[model samples]
Target: MLRRMFAPEGPTFRELAVQALSSVEHGYDLLAPKFDHTPFRTPESVLAPVSRALRELGPFGSGLDLCCGTGAGMDVLRQVCRERVTGVDISAGMLAVGRARETVPARAPRMEWVRADARALPFGPVFDLVVSFGAFGHFLPGERPGLFAQVRSVLRPGGRFAFPIAAPSRPGSAAYWMLAGFDAVMRVRNALWHPPFVMYYRPFRLSDVRAELARAGFAVRLHALPELGRRPDGSPRCRLVVATRAEAV
Candidate 1:
């Protein structure tokens, strides 16, 4: 099923190989056109539930889609924000595709795109809400503190940085082993290659991430996305992490 979809509309194996060997920014630029067709794009199953969750929390003034990719996450913002919305990413090619694909209706919140690394966002502390989807695997564990701080810096006091995170697959399960193998391969690839493509399947554990968010000056909370269903243990399969910036002193 997935193979048929990729072969027809997605990037060829050679294209993906070339991308994997390139720098993250360059690789995404190359992948921009066909990104939506690829599994790398956040699936609608995830996005729809996220949208429903955010809707309950918002009617926000302005929003930013951090590392927006092809702007699929922007649909969530459009539904919940009453003012302007912006999508920021490092790759010019990805930004271009997002801008072209997301056309605003006359009454919709205004849309804008900016090309900037998430590490150094080019904006004031203005946004009321900021959301990211499926972009965290790029950041190493050590880099998360700075990344969270950067996110905090761009948000107004009490503004929320929301993103959905799935529960880790149980240890020794097939999903666990698969993710473990993928991360191991990424480690090897980064060691052997120049301009490392930093996409790993593991390493962003919820416990560690919650601690980092607290240290980064956020009041972190979790909202279970019941729409995505529950695990066999009765815990949520996915939860939305809503990290609110501390109000001004």
Candidate 2:
């Protein structure tokens, strides 16, 4: 599975190393063309279940995809939203690729792409639903509060901000150790490099995220994505965090 995912068709190790060395925006700019082929891209197994879950919550009107990398979350918006779907990201290269790949049926909602920082979004309280996929690792832990607030600011009263999160790997397990090592490397790289790549496999805890969402004036909820299946302990392997903007906010 690992070999097939990082196959020859994807960006080579040298190319990935170059990307990691550059500033986040420039790195994605260099990587934009081949990103979908990489293991970093959100897989269909996750997307499919997310789409189904969002469809159940909707009939939503304008939907926004926050930090939408190459617009993977647009697929979910298109399925659930009624009027329009927009993808906003910090990387121009990523937005361009998403724009180029977009195909909408006549009946489908209109689509738009914007380039902007997630921390300071250039939008009002206009979106009815918002979703992001596999892009949180780009943010530092300190940015969570402001990031959640920014998400709330762009959502209409009673609007929703949704994303998928998986269960953390068990401690001492290979996956857990691998992620720990990856985070350690990232920390070292950020300490030594001029422009940090800002990708870490861990540290976005569910409890902290939910608390921050509440602090940002969102009423949070969780929905199990059964299609993703469960762990050996019978707990859900993945879940969708749906943070609705409080009606007063």
Best by lDDT: 1
Q: What residue runs in model 2 are displaced by over 4 Å at the alpha carbon?
A: none
Tell me the number of clashing residue pairs for each predicted model: 0, 0
Residue-wise C-alpha lDDT for candidate 2, range 1-249, written one tens digit per residue: 567546877777788889989999999998899888887778899999999898888889999998888988998899999899999999999999999999988899999999999999999999999999988999988998899899999999889999999999999999899999999999999999987789875989998888888988999999999999999999999999999999764
C-alpha local distance difference test of each model = 0.91, 0.90
lDDT of 1 by residue, 167-244 (tens): 999999998998899888888998999999999748888999999999899998999999899999999999999999
**lDDT minimum window of 10 residues, candidate 1:** 1-10
User: How many steric overlaps does candidate 1 have?
Assistant: 0
Residue pairs with colliding backbones in model 1 are none
